[model samples]
Target: MNTIDLQVPHVIWWKDPALRNLYLAMPVLMLAATINGYDGSLLNGLQTMDSWQNYFGNPSGSRLGLFTAIMNLGGFSALPFAPYIADFFGRRIGTALGIMIMILGIILQVAPGVTSNMFIGGRFLVGFGSNISIGAAPLLIMELAYPQHRGKLTTLYNTLWYVGSIIAAWTVYGTIKYSGSVAWRVPVALQALMPFIQLIGVFFLPESPRWLCSKGRYTEAMAILVKYHANGNPDSDFVLAEFAEIQETLRLERESAKLGWAIFLKTPGNRRRLLLIVLTSFFSQCSGNGLVSYYLHDILSSVGITNTTDQSLFNGGLQIWSWLVSICFSVCLVDRLGRKTLFLIAGVGMLVTFSIWTGCSAAYSQTGNTGAGSAVLAMIFLFYGVAGFAWPGLTVGYSSEILPYGIRAKGLSLCLGITALSGVLNQYVNPIGLAHLAWKFYFVYIVILVIEVLCIWFLFVETKGPTLEEIGRLFDGHETQYVESEEDKA
Candidate 1:
């Protein structure tokens, strides 16, 4: 086989009942990303509700920023501890723990006549818990998926963000017909649904086999591989090859793994991995999508679309469009096109759309031209359509895939942490910028998007056609040495 060929083996997962069951259980983890998407769109939707604005004092400036930024702060607070839980307790337990905390947050959010303090507190817990689960989910999904299916399964993991967004957008749109607090409370209370589903679905999931191997439970690890990857046949060639590959890779990793945070900086390969992780996480949040994801109401009002119904309709429509675009690319193109290609496409596409968006916003501001305002609306959808290609698919999965087993959980935690911190800054600054500078604020993202494209071109490597364990060779070169046994050599 040519080394760069991206084609995966043609295994029909549904033909094998065990593999079928394994795939069915994936939603337990995928919903972690969904929770985050729902939270973002839910806030955007609530800001448009009259009763919500009246109840909350129509928070603007720093106060409104806090309403949006607190969640990321809460998620950041949990980052340092989340990986420890994931690494020590097991991925399944870590996920369940996060969901349980998030449910507590929903209870606080839905309490009758909830005070601002209590609501903020609830948002904090929800962010905190959601980050913990999000930190663990991609790692487990990649580790558990059959090698041929791993890329699609892992990439598709975050794409479900749009699924949650779609639900929140339309839910908010539907509830807008009511004229009371129920308009907002209904949407906020529904945040609990995904976590509840996750809590139940998680019980049915198998523990990550690589994690079991790391803990010296070799028998248990092999048993899972045998059952799911090879339909209960321990003697099957597929099962035997996979088991040997995992054992060999894990042995090499333990020998070279670094201690503490040194793992991110101990060597050149580790340094490259750290750079990619930080840049990827930062770009995912700061690349102008934050403006739309959390503050579509503000954007619409600035353009004279003050009617609540029109704003809700546009928000709902955008989510549906985003979901469709994300689903197509993640399932069909992520593997075939490779990581770097899709990322470059996203960067360049966002740059073009956002530049036009900025120009139209300026024209609308200066002349009050409804046509320019209309153009700005079209640009918003184009921007996200371009963004959906990579942000929803690659952000978490690409970062997770590049790290070796020793630091997978910890590295992912750092990725999410950086993402939260970047989000904090963007959420706080965006409203302030829009209030003061209006369209001028968009130029910042235009500049950042240019840098994003350059970085993707120069720094990002193609991580196609390798197993999770084997991909390290692209970074470490001769440092990640694997010996082929005679049975494998044949």
Candidate 2:
């Protein structure tokens, strides 16, 4: 079999020199995902600490909900303005500034916070500062990655989210034995580690070449593209072709004046992009993942696993499993399997797992049956398996590639903004729902999963295998400028 004609699809690595620098920059962007994941679990573990509560006003009832909601609220509140910062200053500075605000937030949280309000304020600032970094990571990868590797690279950030979560889970778990504020304070203080690592890494990485080109820094853009995509070969035909494609696309975006906030609603294609993005983001949250992600300890308690140490260990093990699943799925399967197939598989599997999970939970709650509770525990692992392959992996990468460059960063901001709102609602209501609705609360997710499946079948499209610029054609007519050569796309 001739290699040229065979054209088999395989995940390539360790060959390209450009990938060396690209891989180096990836850790910087991935820190945002890791921190996002860490926040989900750190607070979970902190809440279990008696000393943490005694020091922080022992919040309960509505106040407890407010504690969690503030972070999501701060993030949503920041999104509208944050995108403007990203669009104006470029992704690198936007990320640094966001991380700076986060550093301030962490300082407040660790400063012997003797009041509930202090921790709340610190958590709020943490969300406010972190949103830009989270939103910008995907955009940076989308613009900088080669067409063949773009989907996997962008999705890789979500996998790192679990890496962060695992670290938080284990950190908080290990600190559980410490008396007084040290148990909680030590973990909260550790939050600074990821951001500082990201800041240093970002210090060495290049700005998005597309963003550079958008600002009319064509020479700089070409240099980055050459360095990262062409091994510094400026005269390579592939480099010249990609550069021309980017330039032409930017020209169209400029001439049309389709940019900033209004463009999302003003243009038909953008309106479609916005609708799909918001819908996907919303559906991802409602799929019952957050029920486990934020409150797995409570979820385990509902299933009769009451020992604190057991809960912590179970949570840590589950997080490690999740991180491993996501890393495998994103690295190997994403490119060949395509978004539509993976999403449908994930949606269906989640729907089934959740439906069975609700039954198990109801059985355990009503009859006090050990086997029923065991079944519920099993479903947690199953739901995570399906979910790790979808929301935190495939859907995230797809959303980043679906938007145009003119509004790409802002569009991701809007997408991340919508998730923050859904997340706030979910995080706030889940505890109440657990108390009042019990097993019935899961029915809400059951219905949501059905709708998520239907929506993915009808509204979602495959975004794999296209250059980010070429993906524009799916959303707008003007972006359909590339002429296809007869060479096998693989």
Candidate 3:
């Protein structure tokens, strides 16, 4: 069997002036993702702060969990619509609209004397706004970036997301002693500023050339690509090559028939790819990272750390470690190990962690031994840091690469919508389960992880270094067909 060597295309870098331009774009993308992360985490960190309890009237257990979950519920609820808006209107437009919604959420969250209903409404709007960026950012970045650096660059979103969480943890930790409700409200409101900054920044930046080309705006696409390439001359060979590729992709797409919601379901290969991507997303959310990140303080407190300062320190430390570990994994192993290996490793790690946590909880409940329980909880936290960062980076990389260009946006949107719904379920259900059953919640995670492991082994194909065309062929089981066609052409 002849095998096509699957490796990432090499791009001109370092001496290449465009590398600097790409680096400059990183901070802006990071800032956008940071706000996204901060908004997601602010509520959880705030719940541990004394001012938050006072403002909300000292809610405990399930009620606090419910409050935390509400934001995710709102965000998830709005995600399904994000794809349509993004596909139809373009990613820049989608991102701007999302920012606007977030600003409304910030107002509701920070406004004095706002009713709970008002707060929920604001959060829902914020969620709606977040859906736009979350759905669009990867697509925008993937389309804008050179293929060689796309994985590393796109990882910026997740990295910045964690940075935002870190900021939230430390911010709440530092401000807990300050007077006024600003401790919590300030962080929530700070999120509103990011979108405005990003909105302005985006104006200076180029739109996705792919989107422009899809709309038959070749001149605009070529101009954007020239800027992206920064190769002095607009007619450079690289620029011409890229334009030709875009034209060919567009021609094939137009010839193949319009890809829409109905055809997505009716097509076998597309349906399979959609199911795989969505399931991967769903399991990633359900793997318990969301619960752990949002409820670390509660979980630590349950293990017997009563002092708020101590809990904050523990959470902050955990976030730092997780971020570091994730960065290491993403840099060294993401491309090397391929998607399947990472998911397999992550699933096994989750299963082990959840089992240990369950055992610790059972032992603590039976003997009332806080010390043993604490040790076990510490192990669980360590497991969380490692798996939390790895799975998401892998999942995002996998989802972005697996589909054909024609259906990439719609397929990703559908997958992300399922992910969003999973986020809602995770936000709502995990808290309820934790409140009623506490450590037994590990059993639920364990079950989910086992299923994830099986699904990956049986269903997912290796996509380590294949081109988009080759990867698409794998999904369609057309590799043999393509090989024979190449022979005929030869």
Candidate 4:
């Protein structure tokens, strides 16, 4: 089989004779994903604890819903500004700054005598801090990885998110049983450690080569790329070609408009790309995954698992299995199945599962029938394994690759901003649905799923195995025809 030449320039230099730096960098980046995931999901288990009520003064009905919703609200509030920060300061700086904010947020939550207002304020800070990682990580990973291995490497970040969720579930389950305000604070407070560690560790890593090149620091960017790609036969012409491509891409971007908000809105094709990306991100959140992850215990209670211990254990175990399944599937098929196909399949599967789930929930609520309700609940979780886990992991990877290099960070930030907003709405509405109309709540998810399917089928494009240049062409509407080539096979 013919190997597709990567076309990198020869002037780039690696740290050593081999490309070990690139391999080492993967773990560091993945660690960022893991911590981000863990903290994001940690709240899942803590919601049921007595400390939850203590911190929030026994919030009931609509108030309880608002309390839960406020977590996402914090995130949404900061998202619009995340892009500007990332663009103006650089991806690494934006990420570090966000983590620092998260450290403050966690401290407030853990301190003694924190009122509900304080708890909300603290969580809002956490949400704001957390968005930086989600917004920046995908772009960083994409710029760093080789085209052939990009999908698999980027999915590692998503897999770690599930790992974080599982950890949160188990940590809260174990700690909540011990009896004290610490039960909840301990789990919530632990999130502080992640950002602190990330902040310190990130300083040691190099800035993104793409971002570096964007800023006209071509020599430094080339050096970092060399370190990552050194294992490729240095004698081969592939390196020079790749470097030329990067240079050309950067030149085109700079000549176009310097990659600012003006460029984002002025370019017609870019505007469309931004819209699709935002829609996909919004649908991903509104699909009710957030609702399920945040309110699993309540959902179980509606189906008859009223015991707190049983609920915690069951919910925790489900998260574990979901994470495990997502990792397995992401590692195996993300490259093979491609982004568009997996999304369509997952969307349809979720629609079916949630539809059944909605009916089962309604039945259980009306007739007090646990048997059918239990079965539907099980299916809802199974759907999570198939749909929830796969979609998020792949969505970030796909979104990162689809936009042109010039607008990559801004486009990602815009998409993520929508994600943050939708997530806040989902979180806010989840408690309300659980409190007021338990069975009817999932109907919102079902509606979102339908919209997701329609949008994906109509607007989404297949981005598997394309070089950044080819992807840019697709985005520009200049390349409507796709020609299969040997490089695409990898």
Candidate number achieving the greatest TM-score relative to the actual structure: 1
Predictions in order: lDDT: 0.86, 0.78, 0.70, 0.70
Poorest lDDT segment (10 consecutive residues) of candidate 3: 479-488
Cα displacement (angstroms), candidate 3, residue 194, comes to 3.4
- RMSD to the true structure for each prediction, in A, is 4.0, 5.4, 4.0, 5.7
Task: Please give each candidate's TM-score.
Answer: 0.94, 0.92, 0.90, 0.88
lDDT (tens digit, per residue) of candidate 3 on 62-123: 66656766666766676557777777788778777777778878798778897666776787
lDDT of 4: 0.70
Highest lDDT scorer:
1
lDDT tens readout by residue for model 2, 314-380: 8898899888877776556887888887888889999999999999998999999999999998888
Estimate, for each residue in 149-218, the C-alpha lDDT of model 4 and write its tens digit: 6677776666666766777778877887766787888888777665676677776777777778768888
Identify the superior model by lDDT, candidate 1 or candidate 4.
1
Off by over 4 Å in 3: 1-9, 60-66, 233-235, 255-259, 479-490
For residue 204, give model 4's deviation from the true position in Å: 3.5
Clashes of each: 0, 0, 1, 11
User: TM-score of predicted model 4?
Assistant: 0.88
